[model samples]
Target: MVAGATSQASAALRTYPIAPGVSVNVRSGPGTHFSIVRTLVAGASVPIYCQCPGETVSGTYGTTNLWDNIANGQFVSDAYVHTGSDGYVAPQCS
Candidate 1:
C-alpha cells in the first residue's frame, strides 16, 4: 500500500463565501463605524487573511462580532459571510 502525505501547515488564508444576489460593503476598518472602501458583488468569494472582533453587524446570515480582513487595510463584517464554521478559522488580526 502506498502511504499518503499529510501536512500540518495552516492555511495562509480562508475563503469567505457571500450569498447569491447580495451585495456586501467593504470597509476601511472592521465595522460600519468605519468608512466604506468599496462594495463586493453578489456571489463573490474573498480570501480572508485574518479576523478580529469588531462592531457587531447583522446581515442575511445573522449577527456576528467578527470581521474578516480581505486585503491590505480592507475589512468586511463576518455577519454577511458564510465561513463554513461558527468560530474563528484564521488568526486574529494584530
Candidate 2:
C-alpha cells in the first residue's frame, strides 16, 4: 500500500520528499562562498535538477560543506542555509 511513497512519482519522474526535519541550504554556488537566497520553511519543496558535487572532507580544507562551492570559495562569501528536507531558498535560483 503506497510502498516507497517518497520514491514514487508521476511518470518516470521520481520525487524525493524532504527528509523529516531536514534542511537544504540554498547556497549561491555548489559549495560555500555564496550568499543565501533565502530560507524555505519545513515541508516546502523544490525540483532539484543537479546536486552539489559531493566533496571529500579534509582537516586542512574543512568539513564537507557542499555550499562552499559558491564563488569558488576563494574570493567570495559563503551562504549557509538550514531548513527542513523539502525547504530551500529559490529567489536567486530563479
Cα lDDT, all candidates: 0.84, 0.34
lDDT of 1 by residue, 1-94 (tens): 3355433333554466886789999999988989999999999989888899999988877888899998989998888888877678778999
- Candidate number with greatest TM-score: 1
| Deviation from native of the Cα of residue 9 in model 1, angstroms | 9.0
Model 1, C-alpha of 2: deviation from truth (Å): 13
TM-score of 1: 0.84
Task: List the candidates' TM-scores in order.
Answer: 0.84, 0.37
lDDT by residue for model 2 (1-94), tens: 4966654233224333333354444555554345555544445444443334333322222343332222222211112222222223221332
| Candidate 1, pairs of clashing residues | none
List ranges where model 2 is wrong by over 4 Å: 1-15, 54-94
RMSD in Å for all candidates: 3.1, 10.2
